[model samples]
Target: MLRAQRAARPTAVRIDGIVKSFGGACAADGISFEIERGTIHALLGGNGSGKSTTIKILAGVYQADAGAIEVAGVRHDARTFSPRQAWDAGLRFVHQQQTTFADLTIAENLAIGHRFETSAGGRVRWRAQHRRAQQVLDQFGIDADPRDELAHCGIATQTMVAIARALQGVEQGDERVLVLDEPTAPLPPGEVRLLLAALRRFSRDGQTILYVTHRLGEVVEIADQATVLRDGSVVGRLDEGEIDHDRLVELIMGKRVQAVLSQHTRARRGDVLLECDDVVGGPVRGASLSVSAGEVVAVAGLLGSGRSSLLRLVAGDLRREAGAIRLAGQPVDFSGPRHATDAGVAYSPEDRLASAAFLDLSVRDNIGIASVGDYFRRGILNHRAERRDARRLLSEFWVKAASTEVPLSTMSGGNQQKALLVRWLRLHPRLLLLDEPTQGVDVGARAEIWQLVRNAVDAGAAALVVLSDFEELVEVCDRVVVLSAGRTVAELDCDGLSDGVLEHAVLSAERAAA
Candidate 1:
């Protein structure tokens, strides 16, 4: 009877007055929302908007301070919900970093999360496991051999395997809800369409999904219901017809903002500040582009098309095998990043927590560590001057934090990115190399970060950025350079560039290469 009741319920999940706080900061303040069964519901918000906190609570990663959640018509205390309970309640999660082993076979990857079929004699049943894996793959429209290694599959296939593993055993009338947090962040444009199609198929077959992403276009295309959260509270809820780019942005930002990057106006281009000719390094083969002072050029391409490798070669992080680089009309070859830094070139990598930021260090230290010599006097470090500059730059960059003395990890992802930018922008580099500068950041911080880049470019610094978000690339860039299979395939002016135009340029390059 209880199973029948759960199957009959229209709503899949419900949150009532969910509240979570950390160190006196309320992350989620009495947030309440409902997700109907067999629908794609998007939980939209900016960085530090409490949507993450709410998801963490639902996943049992963090116990809420107060509230309750109803899963399949069964109410449970939020504070005592464990991960085991979530799994038992038919809740599954596929995070941005999927927990699949690249070296394992597809069948092995599938069996890792669930149990493997075994005989009473304690022997493994490989055939049964392979058969079940093949069934799941076929069910999700994944075309791959179950016995093949997952590493041999494309990124889209790997992601589908991850999703299939997550949705294992979650069938019709199961009242299951799959939570996908930025699943498409690591995927390229072509792969994103493949994943979204699979998701829509699941929804059509009675699967409920809670999709969290910063990409508004995907939300518009896939979401059936939209719940916007701001500063830990429910701001607005939009039905399918109500979800559009402008309306969603207005609700997420709590203002009638025209667009996320609507405020950007192109800056005047000066003389060519940095030039690359036939650059060949790592995966970048014959990649070439030029950036002028006060100009922003963006690299757009599919994954492994050498977008990042090109940036690394230009930034002196990778060895240029066969290419000539000219900075200010002077031929230059940098041996390392220090050489680049000394030569007025600043580069910020994509991974902040791993490469850029010192999580254990204070914000002041993280910003000042790169240029500690500026604070030196009488053969001793001057802490006072460093603190002063840190505070000034924090304010200048619009990094919101309690104080400059707090640990860098205490701040949000967006602030961490801004803080890193503050470090580079303070150096006054003649050319800035930014690879996915706004990759993980939310829309609000994304705007602020681009604004900062523009300020630097306006101050005579040339910027070459690699952005996967084509909309942002179209908005913030002065020119678009398309790369394919380690080659510069096309270059388009951003004067009238649309997302379709940019994507078509990239796709056309890939298709031609194929």
Candidate 2:
């Protein structure tokens, strides 16, 4: 009953020593792996570890400089392979970033995946498409209204929608390969559970899944096998029975490493740094909270508890149906994010890689993006000043990179996040908003980022940090705000903040509200 001996079904994909280089630098270095039919295989790596390169090659975005890719035993000429070919041959990739139309309904996004409707008729008849979409969505336990905009929903729900869209091709018994690149990055724990369970059920239905993710915990919980990558090379493969968290970490970093969760000293006494009064958004009740200067304020809440949405309201990223914000006792109205910026607010968005990076730009340019006002003058270029400052930030933030001039997209995700931190910190803003600040960031990088946040607070900046990782909030924040269904329910100081207490409060508050 060994895997290789069972009736000899063709593999979903076989990546054979694929290599890719950009600008004379090796992006993927001789990587190889095989994903079998109807199995959930994970590609585990930190950012810049060639995960992106390998997936891109499989998706036909890159022509590998060496090696070959085989889909269902059919070898692809790396130089000639294209995404259209991959799709025509029954492979689909759902990116971490939003690929669906923002203004379009969920049904429309799914309609694009309905292979049978490739009519030459110049019009897309969506009535039939919705029915088709519903049939597929029904299989995955998605019951959301199809008329809702894909972008309007939270990242977790949209991700489910994305999965639903991708599976349209698979449910037809086309021998499809579904590659999900960090699909759970934006999901809360509950949604994550749903996704994992759904994926497991899908595998039973005979779909081959190649999942790429950074969260090691998720790998342990769901993946049957994991392939580790580092600096464009395949370091090792952990079969279903072989991988554990510690072993996986060792392989992922390409060296033995320790998990260093950040712990910090709280700022006990401080002046009022930021305050919001009577803030209102849909599903968010009249909410009010404050963060002190020289201190970190943590916002903890259950899924759909309005933690992220509240932070979004305060940061000017999301519109407030109504509210008043005060910074240093001055009245302010946030017309939008730029208005918040003018008021000296810098926010690191929850979705770091998708929202924060300039993919085609160099590391220097991305880090230097927020500092342009101070660095540039009279519309004249200052190359030396920019390079000098960029290099300084990279060193200070401990951003791992081959060189500062390297393309931002080529760096590991943790490094990309570090660059974002440097970019925001360079502004020296009065109040900082960090949503899931260290998400997808490694243990070492996470610790360093915490220290950096402390340094910022020590320099007298107030911060409102929203994180789903309860441990992170406990370590860094001076005050805790627990929200339930878009309203601030309970506010606790550091004295009573433990995982159990916080969890209870958030849970109780949610239950009572419900």
Candidate 3:
């Protein structure tokens, strides 16, 4: 009974001949797809493969220049419907990057999509709205008090608020269409599975999900049908039975040799370059570790794992409640990121917009932000030296852009990440602290970034890398430190290690919840 009776079900969405472009580059070209009622249809592709563009158009963020969108068989001009209209038509989109009023309470965030009207007496119905929101939160296994402020919660909880807001229109009589874009990337394994199960529960209730993700294994696991896009065109749409990871990769890349990526190897021996002496922080407890030069050391665990907090403490972005950090066998006092930098440490923060780049500033300024000392003459920025310095790293890192003078935000997401990396790499630090370095980068660029990290380590600088992709840990890291709920549970050495062993160690290292 739980089989694909799509032919018997009503058609939820029908897209035809959607075409869009930017800067003369094709993003979505004559793309066509159909979503059946009560199905989780996945849009899978590389960063620039047009998947995001198609999703953006569906979400009313972008308009299709030459296409038609039909929701519940009602034809749309694609460009005419405003965002509010899309919502009115039962389209709820959850962006991968969670957006919320950080200062607002959880209850306030849940009531965001409520349709309010003034009563005759001008009375408010806030109580009824909060109760309705309570039912929604209960469905997601969230038992926290609604009065809790959103920013005070963990990233996963904040993401859940976004999920609940997107589901607000489900009780309406219209066809329920939900679009979730990479909602699990920021989550750890346990939370990721929990969210995936929630999605499956939603699917069972006749909700149509247009899910977009880069994790191929997840697509194969959860998608009712997989749609592959390459260079802005629909290359393949595979039903559940016909899709596998290899074929999926080939479909996105338009060729073979991708088969080798799964079986690749570049492991080598290196010397220890950094050691943490019972490193202690608010979230990280008694975390002792040693990382070698020319080695990629990874911190692996579930979402609330002390991974990011550990890196932040080491880089001096957080207050060290106790313990210490050593670089090249020398005791270091990292009072702040500046102190860390002065000690030849380069850290790429997690939130790029807030911590990494001056978004509105020129790429030249963002790239030269960290080590502006070299391009400054007695506190005054030397424009000529800054241009030369920015250009040198821009080319070295293979950042694709018109010129160094262009604004950092104007560049693609991958390029911005590259610029951030360049900003730190120029420092030639003894240690590199990369927190989700390639979070939103494209696959091709992801490989390049990996190479850049490896090249830095190979150059004799110790590296501590934090990645969402567990496979990336096995691929590039020589040693992995497993953190569980803000504690170091195990240290898995990569010497003669297989992917299976690394994964098991990471999973098994979890301490019993206290």
Candidate 4:
């Protein structure tokens, strides 16, 4: 009956004929979709398919070239819609980045962008503000104290607080719409569950949520309705009964993609190319692993379980406190990343935007920066040779960019990642240390990246990868190493591995450690 009643509710938002373009690229080509009131409506698409552009237009970050947006049955010009107007109309957005300050109290974080409680004499009412924050926290099932610092709370709790802040003063009404843009992208497996539960609870309380995410599993779990976009046009819409993992992927990819299975026969494992004998550094508490030539070994763990730190330690980005690292049977200690690179090792960090990518530079520069010496002749840089090599690498890697001269930031997340891979592959490294190599890429791009890695491994290279998604781990890796509390707990072959089996191993190990 609740579902039936929700289905009968009026449309919370209706986007009609929305069109946005960027330098001949049609980002939102006559996009149209209707979000039902008090339902969790999902907007999904591949990277660069214009999901972000449409949301930005609705959020007033970008003005649509032509279209109309109807909120609560009243139509408004998309071109004239501003952020202030969107806020006034009860449309709120919670982005993927951590927007809330960890140093501030929960009450103070809530008070931002909203009028603080004050007396007529202009004195701030701290007690009243705390009381209101407590009420909001209680409404969201958050267990943290309102006066406590936000950093004291867990990641999921912090995200819930951000949602609570956006939803302040929003009641069970028709005008309210909360947009969550990849809210779980940065969260771990456990935290993602908590946030998804909170979202379901919010929808139950008549909160209209427009959720945007690439994780189809989350969509299957929470979304009552979903709209799929491809190449800036609406391709398909799925109702509650029709939303499934395979169906959603079909709509997103415009083809029936096979399940990510380890069907491709791997090359025979060669000699151990890289070995960490009880390696200790950063959060890695005596963790040990090994990767052989023609093999891909995956490090599987929850957040802060030393998955990334282990990779960094191997790449010489982190100082090794103890233990031995053997590269092709040589006991060598690298002082820094340059030493590791010089030793034919490539490492890609987890946070690509901050550590790996050069967003301000052109695609050509970003790709060729690592190998600039090869294009130098007698201390003079050869610009023509550099451009030629960059264009060849871009074409070889299947990177979709307008031109080599375009800024790297102008490319989609997937293309940027591909370009980064091209940079590393050009080095012809013997061992690849990749931390979440396909972190923010789409499904099609993810397949291409795996192919690229396979091509490298087939050519006498080895890869050690850290994957948060167990499904991806089982799909791409020949073996999985489980980490718990910065320790290697268990290892399993990927012959018949399932996410359930992998997760069970992780949880059991964590429980034993506890």
lDDT of candidate model 2 versus the reference: 0.78
Off by over 4 Å in 1: 1-9, 119-123, 260-263
lDDT of 3 by residue, 300-388 (tens): 87666688888899888888888878787887768888888888888888897787689888988888777677766777878887788
C-alpha RMSD of candidate 4: 2.1
Tens digits of per-residue lDDT for model 1, 1-514: 0011123228889999999999998999999999999888999998889988999899989999999999988999999988989988988998888799999999999999787889999887999989999888888899999999999898889988988888887656888799999988877778898899888888878899999999998998988889999999999998877788888888888877644455567768899999999999899989888999999999889988999888888878898999899999999888877889999999998776788889999999998877999888989999888888888989888999889999998888889899988888999999999989988777788888988898889889999998988877888899989999999999999988798888888988999999
The worst-scoring run of ten residues by lDDT in candidate 3 lies at: 257-266
Candidate 1 pairs with clashing backbones: none
Q: Tell me, what's the RMSD of every candidate?
A: 3.5, 4.4, 3.6, 2.1
User: Could you estimate the TM-score for every candidate?
Assistant: 0.95, 0.83, 0.86, 0.95
Candidates, ranked, lDDT: 1, 4, 2, 3
Better of 2 and 3 by TM-score: 3
* Candidate 4 off by > 4 Å: 1-6, 113-127
Candidate 2 lowest-lDDT run of ten: 1-10
Worst 10 residues of 1 by lDDT: 1-10
| Clashing pairs for predicted structure model 4, backbone only | none
lDDT of 2 at 198: 80
Per-residue accuracy of model 2 over 419-454 as CA lDDT, tens digit each: 888888888888889988887665556767777888
Angstrom error of the Cα, residue 79, model 2: value is: 3.1
